[model samples]
Target: MSTSDPYVDLRSRAFAIAYQMLGSVGEAEDVMQEAFLRLHRTQRDGETIASPRAYIATLVTRLAIDQWRSARARREQYVGEWLPEPLAADPSPGEHAETADSLSLAVLVLLETLTPQQRAAFLLREVFDYPYTEVAEIIGTDVDTTRHLVARARRRVRERRPRYHATRQQQRRLAGRFFAAVEHGDLPALEELLAQDVAMHGDGGGRVPALGRPLNGRQPVARVLAAMAPLLARAGGVRFDLTKVNGQPGALVFDTRGLLVAVMALDITDGHIQTIHSIVNPDKLQHFGRVGNLGDLVRADPDPTGDA
Candidate 1:
């Protein structure tokens, strides 16, 4: 509300841009504040900038890109698995409401595989609807180059996407069945629900002895479930509460103390789970604050006795 700055409009735009790029509220705030500080410092020094809004956006994008690179290295060294922290509410709906219709946790996780430039381009163009010329300016690349980047990025993402769509109610019902299988160690039921070519990718960051690579095929996925049985057994019990991630149905796992320990997201196609993504790395979990009262998802407590 301060009128001291002539570029007030630019500040608001910068914040929206940062939030969309980082997808973390805390991180977005940091980027926005830093960009503004830089702007103030430049003005104080009597430096002139053309299009302050664009300049601020460029700075924020650069910062986000750098963070993405550093995060990639850390994720590479992470423990058991890497899952994008489930948002208490969908971050995508605000800025990315349109493309968000098809958003999935599995897809966001796949985004981690893209380079920072590609990620920025895809988000700017697909999510923000930025034109190619503007996208090029923000990314510091030519328009042709930007176009190619977006195309390639989209193609790669499409290749990894599974074919599936289910109503929220149906999803909830299937999720219940999924947890039941895991709780009882019912491999047959698990296999039945999983696609024949099921793929499970755990981002353990090489910290925990996890399935470092994508586990493909029904047999391999089944083996993964088998391997985790002992761990789940040792934990005594687990509870799957529904939550939102990138605006899609996600599962939040908590321990007896109600402290969140892990989150799982699935990609279902034709009533079958094609992909199961589990995020257990504590560092990643930090971004996702406590799963606020999920109401009925918690009330049902399919395995409340901790013996499911």
Candidate 2:
């Protein structure tokens, strides 16, 4: 929107590229700014960019891959389960509706299983529809290698991804029921709503009270939820807002004080909750405004009332 900025026109695409690669809003915005700086310097130095879009795209892709690789080590050593930062909704880019399939929390988590080159290759070719030749050029690999990277990454994602992603309406009904059972401490009803092998993943990021490991099976998960129901009744009880999270049907958790306390995303299959991702990291809630610290809630309640 700034005519004074030379890279203004390419900003959206640059953001899209960086976001898809880094899977973090803060880092994506930062990488895009770096891309713009480089673009400005190049043009200011009397260099004519024959294809500014490609040039910027390539720049952002490379930068994001570098950051992602470096961050991978830190991520692996992170205290608890790591979930991608949740975005409330897709941001608009003028009139064109930007596709957000790859930007979802689910897909981004799957992308983490990939190597940086594989992620870059797959996103460029599969998600962005870039040509193999161009993807290779951008990734600094051969065309065949780029094609192989995309193929390998795609296969792993397909195999690990949920069999079905329920409709938003279905998700709303399901989430409503899931938490209702929790509020009522009805373990049987809640367990029935989940798949037999359902697994719940909580990401407290070692900064909050969360399940230290993935809880597997319906019975165990249900029992834990039932036990925590009372604690969730703090203040005015936990309120659930059926909202879009990273382009998927998810819910935001707010305490009685109207502060966002958690981000909950469910992967549904066959009308059943397959996986529940509970993100309670305060660091991941900056977008939700000033949220109360998890420590405060733990100290105050210290009771059983948790949600994912």
For model 2, residues 1-308, the per-residue Cα lDDT tens digits are: 75596556679778877877876778888999998889889999999999988888899999999999888888889887888877777445442222465766677888888999999999888877789998999999999888889999989988876555677688778878987786687988998898999988888877787877788998888888787665555545677787777665678887878888888877778889888888888888886797765545555644233432
Which window of ten consecutive residues has the lowest lDDT sum in model 1?
Answer: 299-308
Cα distance off (Å), candidate 1, residue 72: 3.9
Off by over 4 Å in 2: 1-10, 90-100, 300-308
What is the Cα-based lDDT of residue 16 in candidate 1? 55
> What is the Cα root-mean-square deviation between model 2 and the actual structure?
3.3
Give the distance in Å from residue 109's predicted Cα in candidate 1 to where it truly belongs.
Answer: 3.8
Question: How many clashes (backbone N, Cα, C below 3 Å) per candidate?
Answer: 7, 4
> Model 1, 1-308: lDDT tens per residue?
76596766676567556655554456776888888899889989999987776778788998888776676777676554556555545553245444553345666667777888998898778866878998999999999999999999889978975555887777777877877787677888888888898887664343223455567898668755754544555655567677665555567777655867666777777788888876654545666665322112233332222221
Clashes of 1: 7
TM-score of 1: 0.73
